[model samples]
Target: MTNPIPTEKTPPDEAPRFAELAGQVVVVTGGTRGIGLGIVRLLARSGARLMITGRKAHRLERVADELAKLGAEFETRVSDVADRDASRRLVDETLAAFGTIDALVANAQSYINVKPLLEITPEDFDLVLDTGPRGTLWLMQAVVPAMQARGRGRIVTFGSSMGQTGAPGYGPYSAAKEAVRSLTRTAAREWGRFGITVNCICPASASHRLPTNLDGDDPRARAFAAMYKDHPLGRDGDPLADIAPVVAFLLSDASQYLTGQTLMVDGGGILRA
Candidate 1:
């Protein structure tokens, strides 16, 4: 029951055609792997100067080295978003290195095993909320002021399919991501006057974090395959191929009028609002 791989041919006009972000600076949290890595790769290809953050120093260094080889001017910081001070320091360092901030992608998040409400512990709830919701707020607070002074910025946060539909056994994760959605709107409303746009991307894909306990022959994966079987354009999303161009557009001047919206990159899996 293998899921059919999704094809992602770029539309002739939609290919990476934004104004060159040659000197623009971007900070992508959790950029060491998976979806975050996809974003870094695309932004680099578009000539953006990137600064990525991850908790693991070794892994961050490795990713930085690889991006550097691509001739991308980038740096990495080992910082935990949950730590307010550490998050602030990362932003400070980025500004020091690049002299200004243009876009901030708040993508770091932690998800645990799905559990019934009664089985959830305080620690479990806090871990999810702190990273997804609280961390997003703290990171935004740190970067927005600078953007405001400059009178422009783009903040892209990550929400999820689980957050939008409230799927079973994902109570904690759902609650946290829902909070991110709320924050996205609130920040958008507050920052619109400053030429800043805040938005969320609800992405559903086979990222580095695979579901635990799913056998190769498991029905759950089959169920997912079936769910996406009739995608308007059949197949799953390639984080880099499908999502990056959209993000680059949002981060560019062309999307100046779009704000506070939740855009899904789920291969049309969740169609209705």
Candidate 2:
């Protein structure tokens, strides 16, 4: 069975309007599910042409079809960000389909086996780093030239609160996320002159296992409840409500002056000074 396509929960008359993005083209990695999908849906509503990618062809096609229903102009690629060659090619494929690239959302990531810091192997570290920061670097390098030609671009990368305050049993994943934050800051400074803004978002929106998975009295449910109880907000965020609108802002012209910052959309979970 396929995951159902998401619908805007707001009534047509009450939907929030955003800046025009009719001719803009965006490339979203890992765009088939989770917060990435939420970002894509918002962009679709804004009339942006999109190039969305995922490791699974079936999922990519399913997502593309759903976007088509919204009258979105888009293309889909089945590629892994961990493959440097494929990541570069993804840029080429998007430009081929869309003529130019205006923005990129580097949302692809991998969480390797959760284990204690001492027990984390070199292989595990490599897997997490390779998929997270390494892949983001490759895609950024590939897309920068196009943005330079136009003298403008928007780039959004994913960071995590785990990177700031380390999480137990998530050592390698946390480290990789920190590396991505470093990359985001460095790129923002380097590319600012070229009219590109790079920022990171640390989102605590629901993962695939959301309300349904939170149901029942299993150990997982109890653990999830404990986690939510500690949040500043009583519950976790909904992707469309708590996350994607912020992403949409970063991609819009209004956020032109902001770069190298990490916006924590975690319902105030982690406070940064």
Candidate 3:
């Protein structure tokens, strides 16, 4: 069975709007497609002012049009989080636009080096590390000053079950994600006194960027596909319905007390405890 990925954003009337999110400002990295796009749609519907970032201009333009239809208050930027200057500028621009960045969805990541650990090159590993942990750290550092000044903020970072469980061919990606999880924990502890909450989510959702092999017929791909089909929920998560709602909760005021935790939003994939 195919996962029913919605092409249209849910109309505001059809979904429950979150009062805590109303007028809040959120910065979502890689908000052009897949899980990032899903997060943006949910936040828009819930009345959050959005600053969405993507590497491609046209992708951001399309998302801008979609949010326009929803009457969403938003701004879009073409940015590569891997670039330190761009990441800093992204946070600065978001704060300038929204006056305060109440939350950050550090959801952008690169997919590369699908080869075995023996065949992986230094470049391949560095690319993933730069795109994942390094990028996440840059944005976090840039945003923290403003958030600290305000004495409150929420940060949601992405991790992966494959990262946690040590997937056979995913050494670099796993390393990067674990590094990001470390960043989340350290930041949460250091900044909690200032009212900042940092958390990580490991999601197993139907995404266009579901690594490189799962769509192929390789043995490892077959194993992963079978695992996805046989998870406790019996299907991969719907990004908007299953994953985004959890992100919304993390961004809400209700989650202020929650920090330094990794939530497996993977519908019972036991790859990680």
* Number of clashes found in candidate 1: 1
List the lowest-lDDT window of 10 residues for candidate 1.
Answer: 206-215
User: What is candidate 3's local distance difference test score?
Assistant: 0.84
lDDT of 2 at 252: 89
TM-score of each: 0.90, 0.88, 0.90
Return the clash pairs for model 2, or none.
none
Clash pairs detected, candidate 3: none
RMSD of 2: 4.7
Using lDDT as the yardstick, the better of models 2 and 3 is 3
Candidate 2 Cα misplacement greater than 4 A, ranges: 1-17, 205-227
Alpha-carbon local distance difference test for all models = 0.81, 0.81, 0.84
As a TM-score, model 2 comes out at: 0.88
Q: Quick one: best lDDT, which candidate?
A: 3
lDDT of 2 by residue, 1-273 (tens): 122233334433343445576668999998998888877887888888999988899888889888888888899998899898998898999888989999999998977755678897889999989989999999999999999999999999998876776666768887899899999999999999999999999975365544455444654454344455446655555555557778888988999999999998777767521
